[model samples]
Each structure stands twice: as C-alpha cells, then as structure tokens.
Target: MDQRQDILAQWAADQIEQLYQHSIPAQMVTVSGDASFRRYFRIIYSENGVHKHWIAVDAPPEHENSRQFVDIANVWSNAGVKVPSVLAFDEAQGFMLLEDFGDVLLHPELTADAADGLYKSSIDSLIELQQIARTDNIPAYDRKLLDCEMALFSDWLCEKHLGLMLSCDEKLMLNQVFETLANSALAQPQVMVHRDYHSRNLMVCKANPPLHDKDFIGIIDFQDAVYGPLTYDLVSLLKDCYIQWPREQVLAWLAYFKAKSAQITDINEDQLVRDFDLMGMQRHLKAAGIFARLSIRDGKHGYLNDVPRTCEYIMQTARIYPEFAAFTEWLESVFLPALNKEKMA
Candidate 1:
C-alpha cells in the first residue's frame, strides 16, 4: 500500500473497532472507484462469529465534496431512502467509513427479460426520492449551472477533442438551443434531482441482505443532488449514457414514471413528454462534452466510447422540435464527421 492507502486502512480499522468493541482488524481489499477522484476500499472484519465489510472512501478534500456527501446521505437515510449508512468520517483528511452495499451495480444486470422489472423497481425508489424535501445544503440547478454544463460540449468535445473550429452560425445555433432547453427545465415543477442518477450509480441489492428497505435497491454517488427540474432524474435513467433502450420502450417507461410522478407533482402527459425530451437533450449535451473532456484532459478514454450514443440522443430529441432543425443539421454534418475522423486516427 502507498502512503495514503496505509493511512486509510488504519483509520478505517480504528473506526470499525470503535463501533464493534470485539471486532478484529483485517486486510483492506481494493474496491472499484467512480468517475471522480474518490477511491474506495473494503475492510473485512469479524465480530461475534460473523464476517462483515465496511467501505472506506478516499475522496481528496481538494477534488471532492466529502462534507456534502455526509450531509445528503444522512438526510436521505433519515427519509427512508436506501442510501448507505455513514458510520464515521474525517472531513479534514477526506476519509469516510460507509456501509457496504456490495458489488452488484444496476448497469450489467440490465437485460431484455430483466429490464422492465429492474426499471420499474428503480422508478418506485425514484418516486420516493423526489418526495424528500430539499434542504439548504442542496443547490439549485439554475440557468447558470445549466448553461455552464452545456458549454462542455463546445469547449471540450468540439474544439479540444475533435479539433473543430465552430463557425459563427454553429455557435449561435447552440446558444439558442441551450437557452430553450434551460427555459423548459425552469418552467417545470422543481424537485430533488439526483444529477448522476443512472445505471452505474444504482445498486441492485437483491443478493445482499435487505437492511435499509425491503425493496432491495441502493443509491450511491449522490453528493451532487440538487433542487431542479422534475424530469432530470427520470430522463437520466431511461436515456442512460451507459445503455440505450428502444425509443418506444423508453417512452413507455417515461409514461409510467409520469403517471406516478404526477400524483405527487402537477405534471400532465404532454408537458411531461416535452420536459422529458428537452431535459434529455440538455443532459446528453453535457454528458457528451464531459466524456470528451474525460478523454482529453483526464486521460480516461473509455468514456469517449459513449459520446456517439449520447450525441445520438441529442439528435433524436432535436428532431421533435422545429426550432432545433438547424442545430440538428450542424450536429450531423459537422460534429459526427469530426468524431468519425478522431476515431479513425
């Protein structure tokens, strides 16, 4: 183990022993990490003839928001949301001891036979999540933040990664469409938006023991939660970047979510569909840009593989509205050719 790993293991051991007086310290096994700078490890220990594990997070204070994670986890956990329990944390050192949700991510479990049931079950949890009242700690997904996120596509994907210099008309079209999308988001009924709520961030807890809820799903990587448009989380799930579903199937699930969501919020069928479509375009633009940035700046090239799929989402959604016709044309003629060239070379 390196210096930081050694420190994390010792601190995690001490924290676990404090919680269970007779617990014996064991080796800290490495666990997978997410897109951000956070690294995770699991320390397996024994107490009362039973072996258990606790996940230790190494989120550098400079890069990640450890404080917001603890605050949001506590708030959601109290509200009966299936978030991992926070046992102990050292905010100064950026280490946290969290309950183990185990290794089953909702991403790989998705299949033709299993997709419907898995999605419906997750949608059930989402309805419960949006019902939780927003607090001061949660920020608003305002126009500024929305615009800034969309800018990633132009800055990273177009200019930096693809080496394309946008024409004057191209920039104007993007700016106009961005304004329209952000306005649509603001006009919707605001709710708690789990910014990165998707297959990778969701855990299928079926094989693991049910501790938090009998429902058997766990949510993680929620430090970026915000009070935003109601359709944000829904669109993120159905139009996931990691996986794609048929358009018909996606809208079917969208209707299911809207039917349930409208019971709590004042959303009708037409408005929900428009909101879901527009919200997806905005998210895909941001996501495509982020994926390009991840490859160019962060040296995480695997994410770029999802950029084409993400852009296809933007194109399909753009076709629904007449105002986006020119933007859609630019994406096809300009963006796609550049991407294909990059892939070839």
Candidate 2:
C-alpha cells in the first residue's frame, strides 16, 4: 500500500479493535465515495459462521466534520428518521464507524411500480423530521450561503468551465436573477432540511432488521443538515439531480407531500406547490454549478454527464413562470447551445 492507504488501513484496524474487539483482516474493500472529501470502506468479518460488515469512514478533520455527523445522526435517529446509527468515532483521526445499511440504493431500487410506495415512505419520514424541535441550535441556511452558492455558477461553471467571459449587461442580468431566486427562498417557512435528500443518499434496508421503522428507507450523508426553507428538501427529493422523473409523476408526488406536510405545518397547498417549484429551480442552478466545479476542481469528470439534465430542469422551470421568460431566453440562446455543442464534440 502507498503511504496514505497504509495510514488509513492502520486507522481502520485500530477503530475496529477499539469498537468491537475484532481483529482486522486483509479483506478491507473500498466502497464508492460521494462528492465530498470523505472516503468509505467495508470491513468483512465472520460471526456464527455468517459474514457481517461494517462501514468505516475516513473524513479528514481538515476537510470534513465528523462531529457534526455524529451529532446529526443522534438527533435524526432520536427523532424517528431512519438515519445510520453511529457506533464509534475518533475525532482527532477523523475516522468513524457507522451501521451498515447494505448496498441497495433507493435510485436503482426505484421502478415505476415501486416509486409511489417508496416516495410515500420517504415523505412520511420527512414530515416527522421537519417537526423536530430545537432547530434554533442548527446553523441557518442564510442569505450569505445562498449568495455564495449562486455565485459558483458564474465563477466556476460559466467562467472556469464554459469559458464564458460575461459582459457588463450579462453580469447585471445574472445578479438580478440570483436576487429573485434568493428572495423566493427566503419567503418560505423554515424547517429542518436534510440538505442532500436525493435518491443516492437514501438506502433500502432489508425487511428483517433490528429497527423495523428503518426498513422502508435509510438516510445517510446528512452531516450538512441545517434549518432551512421547508420546500428545499422536498424539491431535492422530487427533482433529484442524479435521477429524473416524468413531470406528471413529479406533480403527483408534490401534491402528496403538500397534503402530508400541511398536516404538520401551516403551509397551504397552492403556496407549497409554488414554493416547491421555485425552490427546485434554485437547487438545479446550484447543482449544475456544483457539478461543473466538481469536474474542473476535483477531477471528478463523471458529474459533467449530469450537468445537461440539471440545466434542462432550470430551463423547464423558467418557461413555466412569466417572470422568468427573459431569463429562460438567455439560458436557451446563450448557455444551453454552448453546453450542447461541447457535449456533442
């Protein structure tokens, strides 16, 4: 092993020994990682002639915050959300041991027949999660973060990746659009949001488990949870960046969530639908920017493949609202053709 891998292996061994009194084996397999700096590994062991596994996380303190992950895990788990249970943590070393939720991701497990039932389960848990109190202690998804996120579209995606040098008028137009989107977000009711509530982060647990409640769906990668706009998580789930659903189906789910959500919150159905659509536009813009940044800065070119789909969502949403007509024209005439040309080449 190289120097870094050698250190990680030793660290994993120590964590396994400390947590479960089990000796490390040579069969450590690397699991796929997400967009963040964290890395995951699966440790194989035998118990009663059957093989069992646990996940080991390598989140460098300099980059990722394992403490917040632990805190959020405890909070969400206590609040009846099916989040992974934290088993052990080494703060200084930036290592954590988490309960294995198995390999069945909600994305692949979802088919036309299963979508309704699975999404209903997810929305039910979301309602319960939004009702959790003590939200004041969690960091707010304030205007500053929102502005910074939108700026990435111009900074990394437009200027850096697409090589677009914006003229003065174009810059002003971008600012105006960003402001409008930001205001739409700020007008909504605030609730506890699992920032990345998409299909990939959700796991489909086995039917027989210690926790029956979690068997329907298991949530992970929630260290970035915040008290944010209520519509944010709903949009993230319905208009997922990693997957696409038909507009009719998405609308049905939106209506379903509105009914379930209003049972707990004071939002009206019409307003909730409006909030969900506008919030989805903002999220898609942010996602496209993030995907570009991931490719250019992190050398993760795989995300570039999803950029077109994300931009398509933005254009589609823009066409729906009369206020966004000009903005949609700019996107269609100026941005999308360029993106398509590049993709085709």
Model 1: ten consecutive residues of lowest lDDT:
206-215
Residue lDDT tens for model 2, 151-171: 888888788888888889888
List TM-score per model, in order: 0.96, 0.94
Give the residue spans of candidate 2 off by over 4 A: 18-21, 24-26, 135-137, 262-265
Residue 253 displacement in candidate 1 (angstroms): 0.7
TM-score of 2: 0.94
lDDT of 2: 0.83
Best by TM-score: 1
Global Cα lDDT for candidate 1: 0.89
lDDT, residue 12, model 1: 87
**Given candidate 2, what's the lDDT at residue 13?**
74
Query: Would you list the clashing residue pairs of candidate 1?
Result: none
The residue-by-residue lDDT of candidate 1 on 142-222, one tens digit each, is: 999999999999999999988999888789888999999999999888889889889999999844455643547789999
